[model samples]
Target chain A: MTRFVVSVHIVPRQGLLDPQGKAVADSLRTLGFAGVRDVHVGRHVVLELDAADAASAERAVREMCSHLLANPVTEDFELAGVRPA
Target chain B: MKVGVVSFPGSNCDEDALLAIVERLHESAVLLWHKDHDLQGADVVILPGGFSYGDYLRSGAIARFSPIMQEVVAHARRGGPVIGFCNGFQIACEAGLLPGALLRNVSLQFRSMPVTLRVETSQTVFTNAATAGARLTMPIAHGDGRFTADADTLTRLESEGQVVFRYVNAAGEPTEAANPNGSMRNIAGVCNPGGTVVGMMPHPERALEPLLGSTDGLVLFESLLASVKA
Candidate 1:
């Protein structure tokens, strides 16, 4: 299987509010966790793909990010890694 | 008029903003790299839209620390005009040039669509050419376009007339959907207390050309032209 390292951050676009992130931080407090302030939630996606090269793989995933994987308005993604299996 | 467009790494709309200023508006402008600390005789500095520094840490968080931003802050403090659109707006906030932080939308979706903005104040150079009730149609593409501010800050912005634009309906009524992002008080744009620095989430450059659909954004440039020409 082809192994690739793809780091993606599900950040809020300009002017959007992140209630989920706020909720998570609040939950951590209820779990007896203190000193947790200004908590922001993000994502990391790692995939194994058999593609032609890194550029092509990134292009595919970027397209996926633009259309399927992520929302262009509220979130953004950067894709990398495509090696032969 | 000499204009400069700051291009931070990963800036996708620097070219679009430049074309609007130089080509459409028939003004001279340069593409300034983020590392450059010099303004190079540029009268107006534009921080264009698009994800900068790959939106690492925050949308405009990492970019705020860029060397070019230091110059921008200094220029604005010197009574020079500075405009930050979308991601650029985020950087301005991160740099403390403006107030509030951009957060995720309530919908939690990447929203790319047209929006309506009502000009709240026209005293600044950016809106000097327009009537107080001018309406603009522009595109907003971002996940963190939601504007958030504390109650005290919001009150101060309102009392001081720092807010310049608010999302409105086609008939000029304020609405929630018109905001696109769940911004605090439906703020789409704001200016510094000095009115030299303005930041907004809408892409006015995208609306400059009628061929692109709406030309409402051109008036913003026209307003700047009329002011800076003085």
Candidate 2:
């Protein structure tokens, strides 16, 4: 079995309001970090599993995102990348 | 009629909801664990408030996958009544049984107080007891109760009369000062397109008894009973 390391990034949908992200952005400005605009908060999930192949692995991770990892109503998820570890 | 209250590991309001259903509503209520897949033949399903799954990774993000949610979603799809309060509201939205999402309070504080809610419409199973424009008092307790949705979805919900409740003043006017969570359009509660599923951030179950200083929350349960009988 090939062990694959999958990366999932979940972000609040663009149109939805993000209070936490706004807080962070404001805090960054106070710390002298300039040019930070429109900051958004999101979750990064990593999964290690065995799959038949890369195609199967991608499919499995995609299911996980829709079914559990990410909420479609408020959040959007991306299969950032997958690699063999 | 039987009411099913689904309890997750961190659901602290399950017992309160049970008491409200059995003692005040005088209806048979069952406790369905999150791990269990069966709904126990409940005529109505309620996802009571509380920090389910410790509010980890996001409120209701993890608990939405609980086995019983599958049945709850199916129940709503079949035109059965389903009500979600607070954290339960978050789960319902996460499960796609309802539209929009509960965002963090703009103030970033855990707000716990009674607020006036205007009945936007009594056309659904959950709000049938109130007159269309009547105002009711209910308590809201949460740090992430701001309702947000895309412009198209928001317009659709408004045009479809799916917005069941809105934060309002004692005079029954939706005012910016009365909105505690900065929710879009001062929205306090909403229902699915089919009108069978509901999700609200306020804790109506917490305000049902007079000893708790108010009885305005009872109307929702009463409406449910009335709808079930009809």
Candidate 3:
């Protein structure tokens, strides 16, 4: 078994109303950044655990996202990366 | 009928819910701790509003895994009545007791105020006593209260009459100004397809007394009692 660090990114699903993200985008535009078309603020979670390999680690984290970390109705989750801890 | 109010860690409204049942409704009630494995034989369960698990990893997410929730879910699956208020609504959604999710308020503010709701349906166990189209005044205190679902689910919920309450104006019109949280279609409450599980962002327990600014919330408890009796 190897100790692996997994990073997961959970974001509000596309096309849904993200008020916090919109507020931040508006603030950025107010600060003179015109290229900001949209912003969807989300959560980044990092986890370290033992797994047989990177594939199993990623799979486990994906299950975690689906089951607990990310809300299927309002958010989408992606495994950002997996590295040896 | 005996009602059980689940008291999750960080739950602030459990007492209010209990009082609503015991003091106002004149019914027996019990507080079921989140870690408990039993419902204590409660006929109905209430997930009262509060920042469960400190709202970490989203409201109600962690609380969904509480040991008591297993029994609650089993009870709900057996067609037992369950109601979720405010943060409880978030928890119910996370628990999949009800469809859709409650998102951050569109205003990006924690709105603590009284809002008007129109009873969209009276068929659910929670709203059976309310007349369809009846206007109710209740308090909503939350930062994440927006009700959202995919377009297909939204269409289905409306077609199937699962939407139980709607934010409305003084005249009972569902207008933009009346929507407190920018919930889709001004939805303030909804029920499961079986009508056994209900969830709403407003705090009915807090509105049960005239001293609390309104007795409109009493009707909800009355409805539940009526359903149980029938």
TM-score of each: 0.76, 0.93, 0.99
Q: Is the docking of candidate 2 incorrect, acceptable, medium or high quality?
A: medium
Candidate 2's error at A59, in angstroms? 3.4
Candidate 1 lDDT by residue in tens digits, A1-85:
2445454555554434557777888889999888888576656666555556666666666775554445443465654444444
List candidate 2 stretches off by more than 4 Å.
none
Report fnat in order of the candidates.
0.17, 0.78, 1.00
lDDT measured at residue B135 in model 3 versus the true structure, 0 to 100: 98
> Please, what are the lDDT tens digits per residue for candidate 3 over residues B56-92?
9999999999999999999999999999999999999
RMSD of each: 11.1, 1.8, 0.8
Identify the candidate with maximal TM-score: 3
User: In candidate 2, what are the lDDT values of residues B196-219, reduced to their tens digit?
Assistant: 888999988998778887899999
Candidate 3 deviant stretches above 4 angstroms = none
Where model 1 places Cα greater than 4 Å from the true spot, the runs are: A1-17, A22-85
Q: What is the lDDT of residue B196 in candidate 2?
A: 82
lDDT value, residue B215 of candidate 3: 87
**Which candidate order results from sorting by TM-score in descending order?**
3, 2, 1
TM-score of chain B of 3: 0.99
Q: Model-by-model lDDT, in order? A: 0.82, 0.90, 0.94
